[model samples]
Every structure is written in C-alpha cells, then in structure tokens.
Target: MAFLELNDIHKSYFLGKEEFPVLNGIDLQLDRGEFVSILGESGGGKSTLMNIIGGLDRKFTGQVKVDGRQLDHTKEKQLDNYRRGTIGYIYQSYNLISHLNIVENVLVSLDMTTLKGSQRKERAIALLKKVGLGDHLKKRPSQLSGGQKQRVAIARALASDPEIIIADEPTGALDSRNTAEVLKLLDQIAAEGKLVITVTHSQEVANYGTRIVHLTDGQIDGDTRLKPAYPVPQEDQSEFRARPLSAGASYKNAFKHLTFTFWRNSLIMLGTAIGLFAVLLFSGLGNGVNAFIENQINSMVNPNSVTVFKNPTGKKMSSTELQQSMQQFANDPSKLLLTDDQIDHLRDLKHVNKVEPGYQLSTYTVSYNKKNSSGSGIQTWTKAFSDNTIKTGHKPGDNEIVINKNQAIALTSAKNYKKLQGKTVQLTMQWINKKNQPIQITGKLKVVGFSDNAQALAAATNYHTMRQLIEKKNGVTKANYVSVNVTNSIYVKQVAKKIQNLKDNNKYTYGAITVGDILDTINQYVQIAAIVLSAIAGISLVVSALMIIVTMYMSVAERTKEIGILRALGERKKDIRRLFTAESILIGLFSAALALLLAYGFSSLLNHILYKIVKFNIVQISAANIISTVIIALVISFIAALLPARRASRLNPIDALSAD
Candidate 1:
C-alpha cells in the first residue's frame, strides 16, 4: 500500500439547499520521498484539495489513509493529531505570528514535542539554520524580507519533524530568485524520505517536483512521472519522539502577547487597581479609627474593671425599658441605691480584686466667692486616678476635690483658674426621693488640683468625702454604683459577665458596663461605615470587570489567526481557553499588586500627617485585607474572561486561518 491514499474523494459547497460540487471522484496514491505537484488553473479545486489533505477541511466524504491507518476526519481530536504529527503546511501568505520572533515562531511548533527547556530552543535554532535564516532568528516577521519570511515559515513547518509537507501556492508571492530557493528547499525536504505535495498554477513550479498531476476541473485529467522517487531511509523506531506542550510554554506565550500590548494592558490594570485601592484603604481606616477610639477610652477608664449599676425595677427589662428605668433612678437615686451587703457580695466573686462604692451627682452646683457653676457633676472613686495629668496640686484626698480644668475655668473665670486650687468651694446637690419629694444637700469641699483637658466637666474626690456628705444630708448613705476591679485586664470580660448576672436583692439584676463594651459599640458603627464606603468604591470594580471582558473579546478578535495556528500545532480546546484565561489572571495579579502598593503609600503618608496631630498611626492595613483584594481581583478577572476564552476555543481553525 502507498504511504498515503486518497480514494474516491468527493466534496461540495452548500448555499440554501443548493449543492455546488467542488471535487468529484478524485483518487490518488503517493509514497514517501515523492515530490508531487497538483497543477491547476483558477477555480480548479487545487486549494480545496490541499485543505482536505492537510486535515483543515473535515466535512468532505473521503477515505484518507496514511501508513495503513485510515484518517477519521469526523473526529476533531484525531484530525488535530494528524495535522500536528503527520503534515506541515506552508501557506502562500506565510501566516507567521507577527508578535513572535523568527526562532520563537519555530518554537511554537517544537513546543508540542517531548523536547523541553533548552532542548526545544536548540531544535528551533537548528531548524532556522537549515532554512538559511539562522542569523535573523531574533527578528520579527515585519522586519524580515518576503523571502526571509517564507524561509522562516518553512523552518516552522519542519520544526516538529512531521512526515509530510504541504505547500499551497508557496512561491505565489516571491520573486524569481526567492521562488527558486523555496522550491529547492522543498526538494531537499522530499529527499529526506518525506512526502512533499505542492499546489500551484504555473508549470515552472510543477516541474520542480518528481511527479505532476494536472487537474482541469476538480477531476485529475493527466498524470506524468518525471524521476524515480528517493528510497525510504531505515532508522530506528525509538528515535521518533513528540510530547504534549507544557504549562510553562503556555505562560511564556501569554507573557509575550501581554508585553506586546503593554500600554493597553496597563490601562486596564490601573482601572482595576483604583477599585481595589478604595476597598483596602477604607478597610484600613476603619480598623485604625476603632483602635484609636479604644485606646482613648482605655486611657480614661480602667480596662481591668467594670462599673455595676443596680437594676431599678427588680426584674428583667429590655434595653429601652432599662434605659427608662435608669433615667427614673437618675432622677430619684434612693430607689436604685446599692446596700453594703450587695457591694460585699460583688467583692467575693471570682476574678474580682475589690469592689469600691461610688456616688455620682449629675445635678450639682459649685460656688466659690460668687463665681458659680451649675449642671456640673461630681464623682467619687476608690482607686487613685493614674491617667489624669494634673496641672497643679495632686489627686483628690478624702476631703478634697480635683475639678476638670475646663470646669474650673468656667467656675472661677479663666484668669483666676490657677489660684483656685486649695480654696474651699460650696457644693449643692438636689434629687427626687423615693417618696416623690424633692431633696437638697449641701457640702463644702476644698479644690485639690485641676485635671488635664480630657476630663470634660466633672470633679472627682475620694469616696469617703461623698459618703459623709450624703449621710449628713439625706440620713442614708447608699451606694449608687460600685466599681468592681478584676485581677487582670484579660479577665475583665469574664468578671463583667459574672457581675451582670449578680442580683442585688435576689430579684433585680445588675448591669455591668466595661470600657471594652463601649469601645466595641463604637467599633461596630465604624465597621458598618467602612463597609458602606467600600461598597460604593466597589461599583467601579464592576465597571472594570466589564472593561476586561471587552478587552479580552477584542484580544480574541485580533489574534484569531494566532489561535488557529496554535490549534493546528496540536493544542487542545482547553489549552486555547487556558491561554486566554491565564492572560486575564495576569491582568488581575498586576492590578492587585498595584493596588496594594498604592494603598501602602497612601497609608504611610496619611499616617505621617495624622501622627503629628493625634499621636497615633491612624491607618492600619492588615494582611487579610491584602489577600482578600487579590482573591477578589482574580475571581472577577476569571469571570470576565470566560465568554471570550470559550469563543476563542470554539473557533474553526480553517475559518480563522483565512480571516483578514
């Protein structure tokens, strides 16, 4: 049997149910090492026959057998393998990828073989040397002469060492000298025990082959043998080798294309980075603001302690009901006042260091020599104030008070504020009793010092002073609230929980409020605000994704021929899809990296400005935020590329190769 057999092939074109025959009842047989040319005029089915034999046209009815195995054109994968392993096509237009260099173009075919890394590159270089374009291996197709381009095309076709060479109008565009060079190269290919088939219109081109077949209209009209075919070479079967393309090759190809369109890709990345930057910045700002607020609150109060307020109604209440009850108790303090036994019980709880009784008078008036202040509150504590920065004198003793600097200025006038310390002041306090009667208490206290600006409008003293005054006026010394100090800050929450569950009268529940609780509420609001702002920023990400989709579709349209070339080189459908998808992922990665860099720079500058004013770093970007930004970018890019990648993979190689 001949090495290749085309038996009774029939092909046609259809237009609206009308059949137009192109090739009818064509039968041919050829063996290895035979240079055969199909000579024909225009519209004589020369190109159509070449397409059928090259595995580019699979819709025809034919039996094509090569090396005793029948070709199943209906199976796309089998056709792909045949095109990649058995046939090499040299086109009239020299369909070389414009972005790739000469040697890189050859590597496109060799990449499909078992040769890896430097071996594949060496093979490509060797093939280019054979075609006499070795010195121009790094030049692009645009930079090469027409003859050089054709030589590079020949080198690429032979890169994978296929068994057959198909030249379709190979010299149609070349000058006489270059035409002779290409024809001589074809003769050399055939001499190496390979089948060489040329399709042409000129008799001079046909004469270069050993055999000539004339086709007047679809059917073969004549056949002539000029010289005997070269004898087939005897080589070890183990020498034959090929392998599938690797992922590294795909990524390399993708990187080349991306760099070729650097400016365009950079524009898309900038848009995407803007969206990610907004999200990351706002998230970091929210974190920083929360931390600052917690730090401020902790500085003012003891983080290792909780303040317990007696429940007013001796029953469970909703927050709203609790607020109303607390308001009522505030107006009439006697109803919610804690007794000695309750304070002692709180001190015995686990993790509790001690319980200190405290009194707070919200409606108080302080007067010193006709300079008076009303609506000023007074608080007495058991623990010494460590956070307070006193401007003069010291913390309050049992009979002394430390007034806020602002309040002292308001009471004594700003000019006399410094001299007011150590002076006696009269305090008058009033509240409604449990019997629904108004009560008033008055006491004289000596001012000890002025606190720093943080303490807004309150005065503080030791608990003994407030207790003695309360007993003298109301005839009852009941604690309004008790401060329960835990052994360590780490146990604050646990101790607070126990204190909140403690009952004052075995019926009323106590409420425990810690510095951490207030900070948590503030942090919750800050996070909500951040999320809302980031969501607004995320609107731009949607637009960016749409831009990526449009860009990928444009890439598919622009590289349609390149796609066909890759498919012809034995790439699977998924491989083509992966190539495009990998490009999108690279875009996402670039955008994410740019966004992170911009966010870091902006945060650093903002923190520098803020630290001067607030004495703290106010922008904190976390690792998790950076990771989330990257993952979001990748997911969005992957989703955007899906349709374009799928469309590119599904394209028909013949149609794509023919596209303008």
Candidate 2:
C-alpha cells in the first residue's frame, strides 16, 4: 500500500456521442516527502492526470486510494471533505478574491477548521510570514506585484495544512527570479515531509523537482529519480478535526464586498428608505388627527352618557325615512315622542345612574322689549347637561333660560350681553297639533346665564316650564329624546348596546348613540385614508425591490470568478446562496434604519409646527409601525435576492474559474 495510488485510470470527454480520451491506463505510486513533477507537452495529459489526483475531476474510472482508503466520488459530502482536508490547490492564474486582503484570503481556507477567532488570524499571519510576504498581509491582490500575488496564493494553499500541495503551472506567469523563488519554496515545502506535485510543460520547471514523470499520448512514457526522497516525519494528527463551515465567516465576507461598493449600495438604500418613510409618516399623521378629533368631541359632552331617541315605526328605517321622521318630530312634538313610562324603564336599567328627559323645539321665537329673534331652537335643561357640559352657566330655574354666547350676541351687542343676563324676555312657540292643525303658545322667561358655544344654538330652560308651556297650548307633553347617564365611562358602550336592544310592542323602538361610537366611526375613516396613502407609497417599494434584483444580478455577474474560488475552496452550494442572501438582508436592515431616522426627524419638526396651532402633538409614530416597516423591508429584500442567489449557487466551479 502506497501513500497515494492511481491504478488503471482512464478519463475521456464526450461531444455528441463522440469520445476523446485524455488519460488511458495510467498507473502511478507516490509517497510523502517527495517533490514529484508530471511533465508533458500542451496536448498531452499532464494537467488532466493532476486534476484526477487532486479530487477535482472525479468522473474518471479508477481506484484512487490515499493511505489505503479508497476514494468514493459518488458521495458529494465525502468529496468536499477530501478537497477541504486532504489536498490544497494553487491555480496558474493566481485566483485571489479581489475584495479580500491578503490575510483574509488565507483565512478563507482556515475558516473551515475548528480554529476560532484569534487563533485563525494568527495562523493566517504565520503562513503569510512563512511565504516572505508578512508585511503585505493587509494589501489586496491588485495592489501587489505578480510575484507577490503568487506568494499570497501559496500562503493561502498552505494555511489549512493539507497532506498534499497540488500546483498546476504555478510558475507560468512569473519572471526568472520569481520563478526561482517559487520553485525554492516548493522544494522547502516538500522537505517538510509533505507531497508536492507540480504539473508543467517546461523542462526547467520540472528539473527542480526530485523526481520527474513524463506523459505522452495519455500514457506515462518515462520516469526518472533525481535524489532519494526525504523521510516522512511524525504528523500532528490531533490538530486536524472535521468542522462545519461557519456562516459568520460568509457574512463577514459579504459585508466586506458591500462596503467596497458603498456609494452604489447607499443610493439603493436611500431609494428604499424613501418608500418606508412615506408609509410611516402618513400612518402617524392619521393617528394624530383622529386622536385630536376625539379629544375635541369628548371635551364637549359626557362620554359616560348615551342619548336615546324613540323610533316611532318600531322598525329599522332607511336614511331618508329616518331624516323625515326627525323633521316631523321637530315640527310636531306628538310624533315619535317618548312617554314617562319609557323614561322610568330606562332609569331602572343596570349601570344607569339617572335618566334626563329632554325636548328640542326647532320652530320658536322670542321677544325682549322691542327686539325679538325668530327661528331660535329651545332645549329643556337636565341634570346630566348642567353637571357635565355646561361651561359657564348655572342651572336654569322655572321660567329662566340660559342661552349660548352666539345666541346672546345675535340678540344684543357684545357689550350689552352681560346686562341681559338678568332681564326678562317673552317667548312664543308655534307647532303643528296631533290633528295636523297649527297652534301657538306664549310664555315669559328671564335670561339666567350663558352656556358654552359647544352646546349648539339652542336656548335652555327648566324641564317643568317647557312642559307646562307645551301642555297649556295644545296638550303635548311627551319628550323627544332622553339622556341616560351611566355610572362610569367604561360602561357607556355596554349600556348603549342594551338601550338599542330595547323593544316596544315586540319591535325595537329605541336607538342609542354614545361618544365612543362616534369616535370609532371617525377613527375608522382615518385608518382607511392611511391605508390608501400607504398603498400608494408601497408602489415605490415594489420599484425598489426590482432595483435590488437588478443590482444583485449585476453583482453575481461581476464576481463570477470569486464564486468559483469559493466553490473550489470547499464551499457548498447553499453556502454560496447564503452569502448573497446575507448581503441583501444587510441592505434591508440599513434601509429600515435610515427610514426610521428620517421619520423621527420629520415627525419632530411637524409636531413642533402643529403644536402652536392645535396645542397638541399631532404626528405620532407607534412601535407597531416601526416593527411592521422592518419586517416589510426584510421580506421584500429576501424575495428580491432569491433568483440571483440561486443562479450564483448553481454555477459550476470549473466553468466559473475559467470565466474572465
């Protein structure tokens, strides 16, 4: 059993059922510590044989045994392990990753081992120092001369401490001095008890090896031994352990590549951030405007109370029918009027603190001395109204009225409005009777105080006085609406629901309305507006995803050779895909961060300007909005990169390495 064996090996290429033999009946045996050179002409099979021995060209028929273990090319993982741990390759073109520094290039091979963190960096530095290029560790491949680049490649090949070093035309691109230097390094590597195999067509390159094997017409023609092989030293087998490739290493590489093209990536991120910013800003604005409207409405009424109206027909009514019913009730109080029994039933309901009967007359007139106002609406005062919503007025007593400031201004001048508070005024009201006949009623009331303008343009009076005046004229004493006050604001919605479910004569006869219901309707419309604006902004994000797809495809095309290099260095197809995917996710994260920053800054400025006008912060961005933005960005970015990543992963290593 030899250290490495190739028995009766045969290889051929096929083109449309035609076969061209590259290697035939080649038998060879080699041991460690030997600098062996396979020499042949350009059309001969020297490179083909080297490829088979290096486990790169596995489609050949042969028994390839290393240290008495047969090589099974059918298993992909086994081949990957063989390439990663058993052999190292040095290409003729000095295929170095352009974005990586010299030290990083070497570390790419060592990253597959268990050596962690600082230990891997130290090993890469040591290998570079051994190759006489220690000071150039931080320099990229393009910054170095051809000789220096070749040295870096050599250092990278030796970083993993493989058993065999396979060099394919390693000195083809070097000058005489550099060639001599590389050959001397190869000699020293062989002397360190490792097999050094060189494949070349030049006699001068082959002469430096201790043994030379000649190939002609796909067969070994001759073999010559120049000196005795060095003795194999004791190997440190414990240092070589199988370790899975690190995803962190791939991400680091992707970050380096992204930063190398920072300006291009920044432009893409800016475009993406603009779309995200628009969505977040519009959503925040909608939230703030809805909140402002809710506050205004809540301040004008008791949120813990619900207003109930009688449904005269005892059935659901259409919008037009409901409007006509309300108008008829205003013109004639007998229509759709609630009785005293109904009010008492509401007061006995659960969570109901008290019930307030209220009447509104849309047709009315008043006379104060010589000046009188017509078309003035009148409302009866209740406990709920006087306790919660009245801003500056005392409860009206019998025959006393409280009018809004606007109504006071309408009747008299602003300066004389204060003096009218204690003055008496004559009130005359007219309405249609139950038989559809017209009727007139007259009464005298004194002005008590002024209420807030939010109570609408209605004159308020005591419930007893309004009822007495109505009954005296045409015998109408029913209330048009009733106010049901709940014990707490939290139970307003529940109580309102119960009131709406109340029935009269086996049909629902009442409708309830709470401040929360009004607010909910308003907020619903606001959310709809926000959604529409966000959808428009999302069109730009679609365009941004297309931009990402185009950019990733371009990156794959530009770095085709780098993809090949990674494949040759024992990276799986999934690893290649993850590299591109990781880069895209990083772009998404950066764009999301930029959008958040811009939204915060703009919201601050808008809030400052709005606070002066509305006395409230009117643009709020919530945590949910931020989280949703980030998730949207990442999902779009990942979907955009999928096609390009799969394309890069499926590339053939040999074909990619051949690409310019």
10 residues in a row with least lDDT, candidate 1: 381-390
- Model 1: residues >4 Å from true position, as ranges? 237-244, 311-335, 374-378, 382-394, 413-419, 431-438, 449-457, 500-508
lDDT of 1: 0.84
Question: Whole-model Cα lDDT per candidate?
Answer: 0.84, 0.83
Model 1 lDDT, residue 392, Cα: 72
What's each prediction's TM-score?
Answer: 0.90, 0.86
Candidate 2 lDDT over residue span 1-660, tens digit each? 679999999999899899999899999998899999999998798888887787767788988899899988777677778877878788889999998899999988888788877988998999899989988878999999888998998898887788889998999999999999999999988998889999999999999999999999899999999888878888766565535578898788888888988788998899999999998899899889898887767766678878788876677653345546777666555656888898888988999888989877776776776787775567777644535344555668898987776656667877777677888888887655557577787888888877665334367788889888877787467787888889998888888878877887798777776777678778999999999999999999999999999999999999899888877777778889989998998898889999999999999999999899999889989999899999999998899999999999999777787899
| Model 2 spans with C-alpha error above 4 angstroms | 7-10, 14-18, 25-31, 43-70, 240-242, 311-336, 360-469, 501-510
Q: What is the clash count for each candidate, in the order shown? A: 1, 0
Q: Name the candidate that leads on TM-score.
A: 1
